[model samples]
Target chain A: MIDLELERFVYFADLFGIAIFSITGVLAARGKQIDLFGVMVLALATSLGGGTLRDLALNAHPLIWIADPLLLWAAIGAALLTFGYCRFWVLPRRALLVLDAAGLALFAIAGAEKAMALGFSPLIAVIMGISTGCAGGVIRDVLTGRIPGILQQDEFYATCALIGASFYVLLHGHLDANLLALSAMTLIFVIRLLAIYSGFRLPVFVVA
Target chain B: MIDLELERFVYFADLFGIAIFSITGVLAARGKQIDLFGVMVLALATSLGGGTLRDLALNAHPLIWIADPLLLWAAIGAALLTFGYCRFWVLPRRALLVLDAAGLALFAIAGAEKAMALGFSPLIAVIMGISTGCAGGVIRDVLTGRIPGILQQDEFYATCALIGASFYVLLHGHLDANLLALSAMTLIFVIRLLAIYSGFRLPVFVVA
Candidate 1:
């Protein structure tokens, strides 16, 4: 069935998303003087947290990473690579931003699809998508003793995910799979990239 | 109704649990040089994580602290107490160990009782109780960039909660309420204290 192909594609995207998040997590661990074990834990938490939370919230059985250990291995591999070659990697920060944008788009779409599979309402599905795409980074920051960037009302990080998730819900079954995926990814990537480059930010709701 | 009284007692136990956990969290953050906001967040996460997890797993609506801002204020009060007086109220680690034991016992009982009230099986209730009692500390450790003490094959932390949870479940509705509470609390406290004083620990399991 076409649905099977879609699922496979989404799973592949999920793996890439995991790798990106893991690499970012490893990078954050730099300058903090954490040992190798601490770095690995942060990497795992960053890569898997969003999906684990989504599964928990939806009461999905077996949790995604538990079911497919390949993602876990992939995250470990990515973290190891980052750790070993970070000094040689040119412009690590820029690379992280681009990969993070790709991950946000892919994860948001994947989360929305999963939510739809579970028969959640459109709004709830969208919310779940955003939560799934962003919660991992939030958990990573909190664990590393940083203010969760997502909660600080800065950065176009979660906003892009919300937009991509909405796009997925709108064009899920109406268009070709590649086109929809590309469009959603482009939407998130472009917005996030622009925000990073131009310093675009949303207004904070300061409590008086 | 008896159910009402039981609920009230569990609620108070949970509040006390939060206060105790917040104090520890605040103490943990003291030497780390985190800002005031970060300190409050660490305290809140340690105090509130277990209950939030319990509510989410049980599909309980309007999460406990979110429903009652009073609990939030109480945790803040506890955090402020730690920030203001931790240096002055220097107790021996053994004395603090006693406080930790009392907190662990009360939280395990409270968590199990709530799960039972939510109609989960006794097994599930006990698991929930242990998770609710210990997961906050796990979260705190992970966030502090350290391995969670419970995750390691170290002191009898979660095991004590697990034993107390099993005892409470076996005795549920059989004995009078006061006796049940006292026995469960005393069991966990005495066991944990003895373990600490006697240098008892579980063997490590390292997968080759």
Candidate 2:
């Protein structure tokens, strides 16, 4: 059973994650010829696709968005806000990357916790967490007709989520759940920030 | 409840659909410089992605591939065969199109029937059917770095699935299940073939 206090924290984290991811998706579509409907669809896909997949894989009923319409509204609101005020925001590339990392961290922890609460195995929970953190961006890239950075750049993005999820799963029973969740999210965010600044990347296989 | 005899027929059709979809996915990857593992992943995604999404949306537990491992093996086997013998097969473009249409028809009817069996509304059932018929191809196109043909070409491909699914949902209670399933499949297949041969397409939107 999830602690009511932790559940409340998670709810806020989820909303922030949705808004940030939606903003990133809208930014990605800046130069694309996508219209308003397309932008809204892309934003929703980027914000909710990961959680939806994780819920489906875990057999969680009534998908989260269906359960909480507010999440959908949050994503749509973010998209509209971004669409209208993008020029004014003028966020630097580094700022966009930071926001994306923050979203990834929140999603990774929340996904892992949800899976564990649902009684999934630790490995499955970790996979779900990593997928939740990365799949949305992949979907956004695909919709925008770009090779997904996860498949191409290998900038330790998914790896950070995987490590954080593993940390959460390993420490959850021994430590306080809320503390562990926060620490896991922080760990992922810092690691991703470092990887981005340091240009760290995984080695690619070269076919002989 | 699904009739045992009809279930058996649907099972075989599902396997054939998996194989054909896998082959098409592999063929799509031919010039993309993707490695064997990448090709296998793409094939599995294209073959099973649609049903997986449909099952998840309907809250079906033990996803179809998990309940039946043969579907996975069939898809993997088809991918391996295509990877090794694509050059030798020399399939005409027309034959490939026909095979894809057949897969779409089978998946559409089966998906709609399954949704109806699960007691979903007819509208939702038809949507599930259309999703199951077209989602795999969309995934394949996206993964291959091309815009989904369904979204762009409007060659009546998804429209055929929509019509057939509606037909199945509307007639299933009044007709024998097996007869309706076959009729729906034939309708989609014939319409798709005609669309292909006649170069039929929906008018593209022109932004003013």
Candidate 3:
């Protein structure tokens, strides 16, 4: 059974992740010249796309956004803030990347834990975690006509989520759930940060 | 309430649509040099993507593919067939387009009917119908590194689906379901075909 503290921590982390992802989504649309309604749609899709998929795939009714309207506001508010902020002030790119990494880690862990709570197997939990972390970005990239970063043979991205999710699911029963989630998120964040700084990439397979 | 004949007819039409979409997915992947497994993944995503999203959004339990394994085989088999055939024979591009149009019409109507059967609003049914008809191709286009044709506004595509779905929802109460579905499907097919041959396009909105 998950402790009350872990649930509370995850709820806050999820909201933060949604906001961060929404910001990234808005930023991705900078030159697209999309209308405000378009920006809001992109923000919502980026923040909620993965969890919505995860919930539906798991047959959990009452989508997370439907269950809690605050999450919708979180994404919308973040997008509006970014939409307003970028018009007048220069935003730091590196800081956004770091925040994005953190958001990815948090979303990944949250997704895996939800799957685990739903009694899915470790493999499914890991897959759902990675999907939760990465799907929003993919949706954004596709909407903006850019090749998805994760689908490319570059950076840690979903791989970081995969390993961290495995770490959580594997050690979930033996360790405190709260401690395990933090460690897993830290692991993903650190690995992603390293990939960002070092330009580490996966090798593409060559077929002859 | 849907009669047994209508349900049976829609089921067969759905299977046909699934196969046509899978073929299109496989065709889109040509020259990408993706492996067979990647091709299968794209085909499945293309064939099932829209329905999966529609089901999730509507909180419909046990996804179509999960409820009936034949649907899974339909997509996979179609992909494999296309993959093998394309290696030895030149595919008729026009033939494929006509079939794709038929598939689109069938899927849009089927999706609308399902939503209506679930007691959702007419507007929700139309939206769900369009999503179920178009989402899979969007996924395939993103995966294959192309701007999705539906998103491009160069053809009738989703607009045809939307109109057909609306037609069905508007008249479902008074007309014979089978006859109405056929009329709608024919309307979509003719419109899509006209768009294909006449180079019809929606005017792009310009922001100054």
Candidate whose lDDT is highest: 2
Provide the lowest-lDDT 10-residue window in model 2 chain A.
A199-208
For model 2, what is the alpha-carbon lDDT of residue B104?
97
| Winner on TM-score (1 vs 2) | 2
Q: Model 1 over residues A1-208: C-alpha lDDT tens digits?
A: 2455777877887898899899887777766655454566678778988988998888885567656768878898998877767655554457877877877887887888888878998887889889988998987787767888887755778988888888878887799875677678778888889988998888878779
Model 2 clash count equals 0
Tell me the lDDT of model 2 at A105.
98
Candidate 1, B168-199: lDDT as tens digits:
99998999775676688789888988888887
Q: Can you give the TM-score per candidate against the true fold? A: 0.58, 0.62, 0.61
Please list the residue runs of candidate 1 whose C-alpha ends up more than 4 Å from where it truly belongs after superposition. A1-4, A87-91, A204-208, B1-90, B93-135, B141-208
* Candidates' C-alpha lDDT: 0.79, 0.84, 0.83
lDDT of 1 at A32: 61
**Candidate 2 chain B least-lDDT 10 residues:** B29-38
CAPRI grade of model 2: incorrect
Pairs with steric clashes in candidate 2: none
